[model samples]
Structures are given as structure tokens and as C-alpha cells.
Target: MMASIQKRPNGSWRARYRDDEGKEHARHFDRKIDGQRWLDGVTAGMVTGTYVSPAAGKVTLTAFYLIWAERQVWETGTRRAMDLSVRSCSFEGVELRALKRSHVESWIKAMSAAGLAPLTIHGRVRNVRSVLRAAVRDRALSVDPSEGVSLPRKRRADMAMDIPTPEDVRRLYDGAEDWFRPVVALAAFAGLRLGEVNGLQLADINFLPRTISVLRQVQRTPGMAIEIRSPKYGSERVIPVADSLLLILSAHVENVGVYGDDNWILPGRDGGPIWPRTIAYHWDRLTARLDLNGVRLHDLRHFYASGLIASGCDVVTVQRALGHRSASVTLNTYSHLWPNADDRTRSASQSLMDGALAIPADSLRTAGA
Candidate 1:
């Protein structure tokens, strides 16, 4: 039942509301009209399904967000990114119900002003919105303040992967230890992601067919367990190995003895697959040592794409080689990297004119005459 108001013997109004458990709350008001207004608001809140114990607003956004985050199953890298975004959030301490669109807007402005990239800011805003949306769903909040807040438009920098030059890749490849050389070469040449690279075994490579089959990927769960999962976007594909890369892989295979068909190519000390962060940790140190700034291990795949574009591979070829779900994904990432595209267009146009019909011959003969 909704709340009711009654006039006490002292001519004051006593407004009482019952909780779900039959507990009652009373407020003494100076005027009956004020009591009626309060009761009407309670009824309206009930109608809108926004009625909650008044104490619900006392839960802070940060406290509740932690609860929400804990229950989500996220990739380790994504979890780290979300953790960083939430740690830097300035508005997490606000009461869940008291958060306003204005507060969210101001936070966005502050974050943008702090010089974070649009993509990074977008991720941060998304994290906050995810929690606020959950709060609204669970009835701790009446509405999500993040609604109607503007987010950054994704640009090439946000959507496209950055590529490193062949020289930069060669430098890292040459500088890496022998144990890591095959890992670096395959990632740079075959366009395999770190997870896919880590999940490889001796049986996945084919010498006569000159192809390497990508079937599985390794990932670390939120609980720190090393698990084998399908490749990102489930991109199961066979990638042909360049002869040079095949030689490097052969050498790597020969050197790392004690291999079975199912054994990991790059196994951890525990004789299982290594975490992707382990690769990142070594890559971070190697890049620093080689003075290759802003280059990541993932950019090796971009380097591979760059090579394909330079070799005059079409969009569809690169898409399939990269195991992308669609050709547009390949174009979106490396459209700018296609070598001599403008020159080829100009050359093709000139060639078309050169092979055109000889309509001007009669006019030229008349001019000579």
C-alpha cells in the first residue's frame, strides 16, 4: 500500500509510510497540504518503479561500481584498462541516486581537458555509464545520468592500428633474444595476434603446404588462471608463411627441443602456455632498450599489414590474411598504408589516354598542311 497522511490530536499532520517488511516510517509536518504532497510523490514514485528505501541513495557510486565490476567477466587487458579508467574517475564518490547529467558532463570536460585521447576518454566514460546503467536496472538509481551525455566520435587513431616501419621491426627482431626471435618474426610476418602466437604448437605448422593453421588462442582469466580460448573474433584461419619466416620458424623449432605435436611452441616454465602480459613485459623492456618509442608488440601485426600493402596485396587479400571478420576492418585499419595507390590511379588514367582512339590525327594533319 502507498503512504497515508493523518492529522494528529495536536493539529499537525503525521505522514506514515510502510516498508516492504511491514516496518513503518512517520514524519510530522506543520501543514496537512505538505503531508498530502509528500504522500502524492511517494505514490508517483511507486508508479514509476523508482520507489526504494530512502537509504538506497546512501550507497556511493564507487562502492557499487566495484560490486558491478567484480561480477563482470572481462579479458585481462580490458580489466586493466577499466581499472585504470575507474581509478582516475573523480566522480565515483557521489551518491548513486544523486548523480546528475551535469556532474557527468563536467567530469567528461575535465577528462578531455586533461589531454586524454578521445578513445581513452570514451573508454573511461563507457565504464562509468556501464555502472550507472546497472544501478538504474537494479533500482538503486531512478535514472542514469550518463544518458544524453555526448561521447567522442571515433577517428582513425581510435579505430586504426598504428604501424611501425620495416626498419623499426627489423631492429626489434634483430635485438631480441634467440628464444624470442621466432615469436617476433612470426608476429611481424604472419600477422598473428599475441594470443594466437602463444597458442601455437608444432602440429599447427605445415612445411610442405607452407601454411600455418590458427585454431586457438591462450588468455588469462580474471582469476589469474591460464586458459585456452578461441582467437579473438574466432578468426580461425590458415596463414601462408613467407620463405624467410619459414626458415626462422624451422630454426626455432629445431632449437626448442622436447616438442610434441600438442606442445606449446613458446611454453612457460610450467610447460604450459605463457600469458600475453609476459610477452608485453619483455616487449616493453626491448622497445626501451632499442629506443623504439610508441611501438608495441601488437604493432608487429600492423607491420605485417604494412608489408602486405607494400607488396600490392588488395584489401580482400589482407583481410583474409589477417583473419579479419570483414574486408572493411582491414580497410579501416590500413587504408592509409596502401603503397602507391594515388600514383597507380594517376598512371592508370594516363595509360587509358595513351590507348585511346586516334581521333586527333585528322586535326594534326590539317595543322601541318
Candidate 2:
């Protein structure tokens, strides 16, 4: 093992070293102490024969990224997105170790200027940062320049466009396909998530008790593959169904061909488990047919919450029905659904003034006049 210090023309200090394979590595530092600290760490690694120089500075950024991608086992849709991002930018012949903070900042700016959504930009930047973090852990560089970089803040769109009112849900259900109408009803009335709805089995429903047991969820992968997973956060819950919904569910089970004890309640036409996307597709068709504007399938759950709040259900109760991790989330998201107290306050104030002014005239005359 060999170590040396050199001063660059740019006035930065560089610590150079050679490993057992005679491969040379260099890391630049802004201060002499920093350079010496890096050299000490290298010396210790050399002594233990555990030194593996990332040698990223010697390879082009494009080549390094290809190696990184080989180690990533991204799901189908995520792989496509990663590929698009990698291909969209040109990092050819750029040394990985020499990557500066400005390079990353400029790339982010360019992505934003390209009219990409803030969320999309945030995801891409996060992916890039993950790769860089691995490189740092591998001792590819002295420091990670991408660290502490901030991406554009994401702006949440108005919830009104996404959440549907009870009337809108009723209209959607009226136009939905026979097999899907009850699904919408369950979502709006019972607050079951799409996955929970898809994962339901005939055995999990109790028509007499008017309650449904949520045990698992069916989700679709990026390539449209379907699988059943546990509910979000893996918490099993039971929610009570209204009398009307219980009756509808009972009829739906008989009409749709009752399933075996192990079969799902809402299976695809092939008799396999239903995918969430299939539900979304059916929802789109139903909304279009009914001319219901600005409503998504997930909005049905919002309708459920709004209905409960409008019916005088407390926040904690709504949170339980929606399977929200916390009551605060339910309150923050649907607080506007509850009536404003301003009107009540104004009316109380007016009543107080009237009562004060109309204090019986005979009593006032006896006391003062």
C-alpha cells in the first residue's frame, strides 16, 4: 500500500493511494486535515486487506450507472421509469468521483424546466441520490455532493377535484356495471380501500351481522400482474355495514354466482383474483357513462368519510371506518366536510343580545325608575 499527498493547480489538496492490485485512487479535499483524515482511513483499510477502491473516478458516469442498474431489481413499471430517466440525460464520459454539486443542481433545474411535475422530479432526484449514496458507502468518493440537496416542493391539488359527493357516488353506482355497482357502494358506504375491496372473500362478509372483515388486499404490479397482499400497514380491521349495503351485498353474492369458501368475492371474469386496475377501468367507464365530473375511484372512500361526518359521526369514528393510521389524518383531510361553527356562533350572539335587551321592563322599572 502507498499513500501520497498532492496539491492541485486549483489549490485543492488531493490524497492519492495505491491498493494491492496497483490500482491508483485519488480523492480531493478542501482542507489538508480532511485529506489527511481520508488517508488515515485508507491506511487502516489497506492494513486489514479490506480495501476496495470504488475506482469510480476512473470510469465514465454512464458506465458506472450501467453497473449500478445491473444491481437493481426494480419492478416492471419502476424499471421502465428508471430506464426513461437514465436515457433522458447524457452522463457519458463524466467521471463519477468528480461529480460536483452544481452538476446535480443543474440537472434538477433542467428537469424542472422540462415541465415535469414536482412529484416526478422528486422521484427522479431521489433515485439518483440513492445511487450516489451507494457509491459513497462503497468508498467511491470522499464525500457525496448530492447530500443535503433540496428538490422542488410538491403542491397538493385541490381535494374537491378528487373527492366525490354522496350524490355523485349514487350517480356513478346507477351507471356502473352490475358486477361493479356493489363494489362502489361498499367503497362509498363502508370506506373500504380498493385493495381491501378486491381482496374480500365471500366468507369475510356477514350479512346477518352487517359487518365485513378486512384481512388482505389485492394489488396489481406495474406490469398489470395481480397478487394479494395484506392491508395497508398490515392491520386487520372490521367495519360495520349499513342495513341497505348489507341487503345489496347479499343480492350481489347470489346474483354473481356464490363463491367457494376459499374464493374471493370479486373475481375477474377468468375466475382469478380481481386487479385494482380493473376496478379503476370500470370506474372510468361508469363515470363517463354517468357524466360525473372530477371523481376518482379512491374518492369513494372520501365520500364515505364525508357521509359519516355529515351524519354527525365523530372524527375518531371516521378514522376507524377509513382504517386511517391516526385520527389526525382523517381530521386534517376531511375537516371541511364538518359544518363551520361560525354560523352557530353568530346565531348565539344574536340571541344573547336579544335576551339582554328584552330583560322584562317591569323588573327594570322596579329596580331603577
Candidate 3:
């Protein structure tokens, strides 16, 4: 072991040692003998193959986050969120080896105190934890410092049904230009997400069956090109179209300037897929022109589900139409929109109570006879 001891002007001794990789590490001691003893332990640890490289954990948090982000394969939007989390983090020069549960808790508390939305804080904290996890996987630490640390719970996004009423939908559709009318129609009537509506190809539509084959969707992930991936929750399902929607879609396919069967039904100027963003911008302007506020592109989907539930569609039917992962997911989102639950409960109770009170018709007749 090539280790050295130096005496400081303040009468403290310092021991320096190099690991197998020639990285130098040092410890301070009150006496020369203590410094020598510390070096001995390091040398012994190296010989026993129990050596932990301090270099891994000594990396700055910002540096490690950059390294970790490069290897991540999250979609563009999610990747951007992760990148923002790291960029906006306060632990600029914090050392990974010195990270502790207290540090994580302090960060969580600080974020909570800053009045950030619970979901945003949760995502940022999760991104930080995942970076530390990568360090652990790299053997920088024996235990995850983030393990068992309390993080803010993620509150679900507001999926409330602030839908455009039927009249509003008509006004918006009527205002849309020729190229965008079908897009509006699909969003308002078919409840297709922005990506799904943009990703539709002519072959995916079946006029005879009056259904849309939702095989893929356009997503803008971190890379240069927009990705075509399965729908949210990785669900691939067919959604039946209402007659009015089917007719509009049929007319669009026949008359509107759509890309060919193999291409995006709604193609951009360059003859490829139209960006969901561009479509959203159009919708934004249209909604503003029509004086519709607090309406999101996703609200169109909620409108479809709410309408269905009000019209007595069951949870499974809604789940399939929305392409959610499960019926529970559908119910959790729109259960409040279900109509007449109190009335249904009253009717059921009334029937049961009436049955309990009634005497058999034949029993009174037999007694009289």
C-alpha cells in the first residue's frame, strides 16, 4: 500500500492513501499513530476485496444527474420533466457519498413549503431518487440513502368534465377550417386524444364496421422525431363510432385532403404526421374565438365519457371507449359524473322494503275462503 502521513501546522496528522484505481483519499487524525492506524485499515480492506470506492459517491449531484439523464429512455415530455427537475434542483454541488435520509427529507419539506403542486413535487423527488438509485447500482453506496425516505404523494391531475356543451361543440366545429374540421369532429365526438386523432391512418378506419382501430398514437419524446407508440397505458382497442361521427369521418376520407391509406389521416404540410401541438394551437384559438374558457383538449374525452355514463353506459364500456387500463381506472376518473345514483338507490330500497311488508295474495284468499 502506497500510503503517507503528514503532520499539519496545527499539530493534526493527515493520512493519505490510494485505491486500486490510483484515486487518492485522505483522513485527518489528532496523532500520527492514529493516522497510521487509519491507513492500515484502508490497506487491509483493499487486500480483503471489501474495498468500496469513494470516487463513485464523491461525484457532485448535478454531474451525476446529467449522466443518468443521458441513459434514460423516457418519452419526450416525461424526459423533459426529469431534465427540468435536475436542472432546477438546489443540490448543485452536493456530494453523493454524503447524501443521507435527512438531506432527502429536507428537500421534500422545502419543496412542499414552496407551494409546488403535489404531483410536481412528487415527480421531482422521484427523479432525484432515481438518480441516486443509479449510483447505488453503480456500487457507489452499499445502501440506498433514498430508501424509506418520505416523499410527497402524487395527486392525480384534474380530469374534471368541463366539457364543451353540444352547442359549443357545434360552434367550434363550424368555425374550424376545412383541413381542421375533421380533427375537431374526432376530438369532440369520438373522444380521441390529440395524439390518437393525429395518428389515425386511413387503413385503421373501417367504414363497414363503424369503428376506429386505435393501433398507434403520435408522441413527442426526447428524440428528434416524434414517436409512434401504443396509446396511454399501452392499450390497443377499437372504439365504436356514433352514426354522426361515422358519417363525418366517411365524408372526410372521401372529400377532405387526407394523406393516403398508409399515411397519417391528418397530415402536415410536408406530407407526414401533423403535430399534436399544432392541432392544439388551432383548438386553442377556436375555443378562444368561441369564448370557451377552462376547456382542454383532453376535456373532449371527458365529454365523451360523461355523456356515455349519463346515457347509462356501464363502467366496462366506458373503460373500453377510453382505452383505460381497467374499469377501476375509468370509474375512478368519472364516477362523480354518473347520473341518478341516489334515485337508483332509492328505487332499490323501496322494492326491498315493499317486499318485506307485503303478505302473500294467496294467504288472505285462503283465510277468507
Q: Candidates' TM-scores?
A: 0.69, 0.65, 0.68
RMSD of 1: 6.3
lDDT of 1 by residue, 165-254 (tens): 878888998999887887788889999998898888878888889999999898776776777877776789999888888788888878
How far is 278's C-alpha from truth in model 3 (Å)?
A: 2.4
Q: Deviation in angstroms for 187 in model 1?
A: 2.0
TM-score of candidate 2 on Cα atoms, chains taken together? 0.65
Write model 3 residue lDDT over 1-369, tens digit each, in one string. 679999999999989988777778998999899998888877776676444577776888788778777887765666777778777677747887777777777877888899997777877888877877777666565456667877776644344247668887777788887778888777777778888887888888888889888888887665566777777667778889888887787787677757744666786646678887788888888778878856777877877887888788999998998889899888778877776668799868767866997756567689977
Candidate 3 Cα outliers beyond 4 Å, as residue runs: 1-53, 66-73, 101-116, 137-167, 220-233, 260-263, 308-320, 325-332, 335-344, 350-369
Instruction: Look at candidate 2 and tell me the lDDT of residue 67.
Output: 83
Q: List the residue pairs that clash in candidate 2.
A: none
Q: How do the candidates rank by lDDT, highest first?
A: 1, 3, 2
Model 3: per-residue Cα lDDT at residue 308: 88
lDDT of each: 0.81, 0.75, 0.77
Residue 203 error, candidate 1, Å: 2.8
Give me the displacement of residue 190 in model 3, in angstroms: 3.3
